[model samples]
Target: MTVYDFAKSVVYGVFKPLYRVEATGRENIPAEGGVLLCSNHIDNFDPILVGMMAPRPVYFMAKEELFKVPVLGKLVPHLNAFPVKRGMSDREALRKGLAILKEGKVLGLFPEGTRSKTGELGKGLAGAGFFALRTDAQIVPCAVIGPYKPFRKVRVVYGKPIDFTGLRQGKGSAEQATELIMSEIRKLMESSK
Candidate 1:
């Protein structure tokens, strides 16, 4: 394996148990090739929870501001976390996500634009759906529950993949397609709760 992969694997493996992770339905994540992981956002550490539990490396789109820290900017990319500009199209981020898929890597994303400050689910953005449709990659729906600070049990539940190829048959706008994709994620998130 490459240096980056080694580093990420070790880091995640080391922290996997510290969070008291309890995951189920891992078979939902396909064994090979590109995949889009659609999940809900509830905390700043949500990415870590999912990434650590996943059987494979999963990339995240973090806000640009978060990358400004001297050490993180250098280390994040190594861990497969790229920056996304908040409140904007962030074409660069989208392009990077697509490229990762084209390179046969995994992309983990929360349809929600940001963390759920109110501890409730939020309407999801369409980027994850777009990436899946554009690359013909499978999407694994997931739900995460926990707050590491409370010393609580953290759980990440994986669900079956949502295939979007069927929707391509009927006439549908990008917006419609996005909603349909988010709806599937929503159902998985709810069921895992």
Candidate 2:
């Protein structure tokens, strides 16, 4: 098995028993194509949870700093994660993201740009929208809820794909698209209540 599959199995094996992990709306994910999974960031484990729940392999753009750590830096890339500099436009990261989509892979992204320590959804960055528009990939709005506490139930909900076909890519368009994605994520989060 690939490193990703093995790591996923190991994570799922541990997480499923320690926490009540529930996933829904997975059918909304495209079977084969370039797609973006836009999600709310709650904890560092969010990517692992989402990747475990997704129907297909999910690649994420992690912060570049994570890659500097000795062992973790060497391992994360094997599990389909690459580093992106947070708080600024990292053109290299964007190019890598676009290339992943073009190759018909599932690109996972947290539009908030960083984890929300407050447990509330934060404003989304425009990068997610820009990637969606640039690659003409469907945006799957995802909501991951619950405190990352042991024995607490964490829910990961996937919403319908947001289509941006024929949408012009520009300054205003990217902001609008980000808003739409955030709105859908909010809806999904509310539904879990």
Candidate 3:
């Protein structure tokens, strides 16, 4: 097996039992091709939830500052976590993200841009929508509920895939379209919870 596959397997085997990871909607994930897995951010373990549940390796965008950590910087990319500046638009990150999709891999985006302390879902960035529009990638809305605590059941739910292309067809900027996309993400999340 590839190192990435082996690492993901080892991590999932260890934590899956420890955290009692219980996820449904695995069937909802597309069996082939590239797609965006948009989710609500709660705990630091959010990406782990995706990694364990998704059948394939999921690439996530972290902040640029994370890659600056001494040894950690060297490790994050190997783990399929790349950097993005939290507040501003980083064209390079977008380019990387697009390239990942173009290469036919799954990309993960936390619509909130950061962890949600309230445990309630937050508004998502337009980037989620824009990505779907730009790549014509199917958007999969995911909801992770409860258990920032230990030994508790962590429920990860996947909602239906959304095609936002028609919603923005020639009417607005990528920014405007993204806001609308995030709104749809919010709606999907709300319905699942």
Candidate 4:
């Protein structure tokens, strides 16, 4: 088995019993194509949670700092995670994300840019929109509800894909796209209630 598949198996073994994750709307994910999974960040485990639930192997744009850790730095890349410098435009990271999508892989993204300390959805960054617009990849709005607490049920909902077929790539278009993506996530969160 591949390292990613093995790692996911191990994580799902523990996650299913501990958190009891429930996922819905898996049908919304495209079977094969470049697609972006835009999710709201709630905890450090959010990426793993989403990846475990997704129908396809999901790659992520993690913060650069996480890659500096001796073990995680070496391991995350094998799991399809690349590092991005937080709070600034990391062109190289963006390029990598685009390349992943262009190659028809699933790319995971937390548009909020960071985990919300209070477990509330935060404003989304334009990076997700930027990639969608640039690559013409569909964006799947995902909402992960509930805190990362043991023995509690956490819900993950994937909404319909947002298409930016003809949208221009710029500050204004990116911001608008980000807002639309966040709005879809908000709807998914409400529906999960």
Among these predictions, the greatest lDDT belongs to 2
Kindly list the per-residue Cα lDDT of model 1 for residues 29-130, writing each as its tens digit: 988988888888888878877877788889989889878989877777777789999888888999999998888888999888888887567877767657
* Candidate 1 Cα deviation (angstroms), residue 175: 2.6
Off by over 4 Å in 2: 166-172
lDDT per residue for candidate 2 within 94-169, as digits (tens), equals: 9999999999999999999988989899999989878877776778999999888899999999999976654544
Expressed as tens digits, the lDDT of each residue in 8-65 for candidate 3 is 8898887778888888787877877788888888888889787778877889998888
Give per-residue lDDT, candidate 3, residue 122.
70
Please report, as a residue range, the 10-residue window in candidate 4 with the lowest summed lDDT.
Answer: 163-172
Model 3 whole-model lDDT (C-alpha atoms):
0.78
Error of 2 at 181 (Å): 0.6
Model 3: residue 167 alpha-carbon error in angstroms: 1.9
List, residue by residue over 82-133, the lDDT tens digit for candidate 4: 9999989999999999999999999999999988988778998988778877
How many clashes in each candidate?
0, 0, 1, 0
TM accuracy, model 2: 0.95
Candidate 2 pairs with clashing backbones: none
- Worst 10-residue lDDT window for candidate 2 reads 163-172
* Model 4 residue 162 lDDT score: 77
Which ranges in model 1 have alpha carbons more than 4 Å from their true place? 1-17
Query: Distance from true position, residue 153, model 4, in Å?
Result: 0.3
